[model samples]
Target chain A: MQVLYFAWVRERIGVPREEVETSAATVADLVEELSAREERYAVAFADRAALRVAVDQTLTDFDASLDGAREVAFFPPMTGG
Target chain B: MRIVVQDAPFDLGEEAGRFAQADAGVGAVVTFTGIVRNTAAGDLKAMEIEHYPGMTEAALTEIAERAQTRWSLSDVLVIHRHGHLTPGEMIMMVATAAPHRADAFAAAEYLMDYLKSRAPFWKREITADGAAWVDAKDEDEAALDRW
Candidate 1:
């Protein structure tokens, strides 16, 4: 699967996207796995309140099922207009 | 319905003109343009907007579709720009055409409200000191409760 970071999360994570091999069943499990990999990931995922997640291309909650999902994105709440 | 997500600046007048000429029965057209504003400190240089390429178009189309379903809209147009933009530059615009003024105005407002928070774009304000990501206001999210 491809995990993507955007905006401040991208800066904190130090990469825009990365391929990860995981058997996680949900977005939260994936985040937990990543957070254990490095300090940057932990810092980026520290405050869940400041972050938003998207499974595939659709905005969803952290508990959203990742069944057959190929892409996951994490970013701050959108500031578009 | 037309949803455009691009990095290049768009011509508001031309887009509005084209949207207003939707159909003979269309009696009202409403357009809202969002501009990049400088920081309150007034030292901002530019605004950098980043967006999920594939998701932006999809999300915007969904919002436009919802607006159309909620209101009696004859036509809808949404154009949002990403990448670097100077203060005061147009960032995006939404135009709605309907058989009556009330529906046109309401639908246009609905599009703006949803586009502000639902879209994938994120804005970073560049100042002389440094750059900072703009936080999504709580009011922006709460605004959706009206619908």
Candidate 2:
């Protein structure tokens, strides 16, 4: 599966996107997997309270199932004009 | 529904006129323009905006769709600017047209709220001392939860 980062999360992660192989079934599970990757990933996925997740471009909860999702994105709560 | 995510400034009057007159049945048109400010936290001087190419438009469209679903809007126009922006310049516009004032107002507010909490744009501010990225605000998200 592909994971995307946007806004300051990208700046922190040092990459706009990444491909990860995970057996995670839900968005929360995916975050747990990514948080274990490295220090940067850990920092990005740390404090899930401050983050927002989208499965396949639709805003969703962390408990939402990612059964057939091709893409998952994580970023801070948006602040666009 | 016209959605334009561009890097140029737009005329509010012209855009509002076009959106309102597009359909004779549109009795109300509500438009909101967000502007770049010269000061932030009382010291910022200038600001620059960055966005993900494909993702920015996609997120904005999703916000527009949400507004449409919640309101009896006849049409929606969303125009957001990117690249370098100056203080007092327009950052974005959300215009909603409907047969009644309620629909237009609701849709316009919904569009702004969703954009504030969902759009994929980042702001970088340059102060007298240095430059830094702006963090997302919790209050912005809390504002969306009211609706």
Candidate 3:
């Protein structure tokens, strides 16, 4: 699976996207696994309320199931018009 | 329906004119263009728009399709620009053509409201001090409740 970040999350995480090998069944579990790896991931995922998630290019919740998902993106709320 | 995600600037007049001329049944065409605004301090150098490559087009198309389902639209056009944009430059535009003015106007507004919050694009305002990500406003989210 690939984990992606955007906006400030990408800045904080220091990378836009990366391939991750995980057995996590849910988005939250994936976050936990990544957060445990380094300080940057921990800092970026520190405030979940300020973040949004998308699974396989579709907007979803942090508790969304990642079964057969190929990509997961985390970013701030969109501000486009 | 047409959705264009690009780093280049788009001509509002040309796009609007072409859209209005597309369908002979189009009785009304409503176009809205969003511009990059300077910060309150009047020091904004540029506005950087970041968007997911694959999801941006999908999200815009979905928004346009939803508008079409709800309104009597003949055609819908959405063009959003990414990358560094200076102040006073056009950022994006939405044009909706319908059989009547009411439908055209309403559908355009609905598309704008949805694009503001639901799209995968994020904006960062660059100023002399620093660059800051624009926060999504509560009113933008609340605007959807009316529809």
Candidate 4:
């Protein structure tokens, strides 16, 4: 699966997207897996309230199951108008 | 419904002209455009908008569809831009046509409220001092509950 980041989350993680192999069952679990890889991921994942997630391009909750998600994105709350 | 996410500038007058003619049976057409504003410090340079390409279109489509279901709209159009933009530049526009003025006005406002919070686009204010991502306002999220 591919994991994507946008806005300051992308800046903090130092990349926009990455392909990773993981057995995480949910979005929170995936965050845990990614955070264990390095300090930057840990820092980016540190404040969950400041972040929002999408599974396969649809806004979803952290407890959302990632059973067949092709992509997951993390970013700050949208400010679009 | 037409949903556009583009980098190039859009002709608001031309778009509005076309939108008003979308349905001859419609009696009212409401259009709203958002412009970039200078920072309170009065040294703002430009605003950069970022969006998830695939998801941006989908989300706007969903919002427009919801508006269609909620109102007696004859047509709807939404255009939002990304990339670099400067103060006074047009950021986005929404138009709704309905048989009555009240429905058209209400639907347009509904679209604007949803677009502010539900859309995937993020904005960064670039000033002489530095660049910073604009935070989503609590009021924008709260506005959605009215619908």
* Candidate 2 vs 4: which has more DockQ: 4
lDDT of 3 at B147: 94
> Can you list each candidate's DockQ?
0.94, 0.59, 0.92, 0.92
- Docking tier of model 3: it is high
Candidate 3 per-residue lDDT over residues B37-65, each given as its tens digit: 88787899999999999999999999999
- Check candidate 2 and list the clashing pairs: none
Error of 4 at A33 (Å): 0.9
lDDT of 2 by residue, B1-147 (tens): 887878878998899887878998888989999988776467767778877667778888878888888888889999988888878888899999889999999888888888877787778888888877778776887887788
Candidate whose DockQ is highest: 1
What's the lDDT for residue B129 in model 3? Answer: 82
**Residue-wise lDDT of candidate 4 within B1-147, one digit each (tens)?**
999999989999999999998788999999999999988878889999999989999999999999999999999999999999999999999999999989999999999999998899999999877899999999998998988
Q: Write the per-residue lDDT of candidate 1 for residues A1-81, one digit (tens) a residue.
A: 999999999999999999999999999999999899899999999999999999999999999999999999999999999
Judged by whole-model lDDT over C-alpha atoms, candidate 3 comes out at: 0.95
Interface RMSD of each: 0.4, 1.8, 0.5, 0.5
Shift in Å, residue A72, candidate 4: 0.3
True-vs-predicted CA distance for residue B131, candidate 2, Å: 3.1
lDDT of 3 by residue, A1-81 (tens): 999999999999999999999999999999999999999999999999999999999999999999999999999999997
Clashes (candidate 3): 0
lDDT of 1 by residue, B1-147 (tens): 999988899999999998888688899999999998877888989999999999999999999999888899899999999999999999999999999999999998899888989999999988988888999999999999999
Candidates arranged by TM-score, highest first: 4, 3, 1, 2
Candidate 4 segments exceeding 4 Å error: none
- Superpose all Cα atoms of candidate 4 onto the true structure and report the RMSD in Å to 1 decimal: 0.7
Candidate 1's DockQ is 0.94
Q: Positional deviation of A52 in candidate 3, in angstroms? A: 0.7
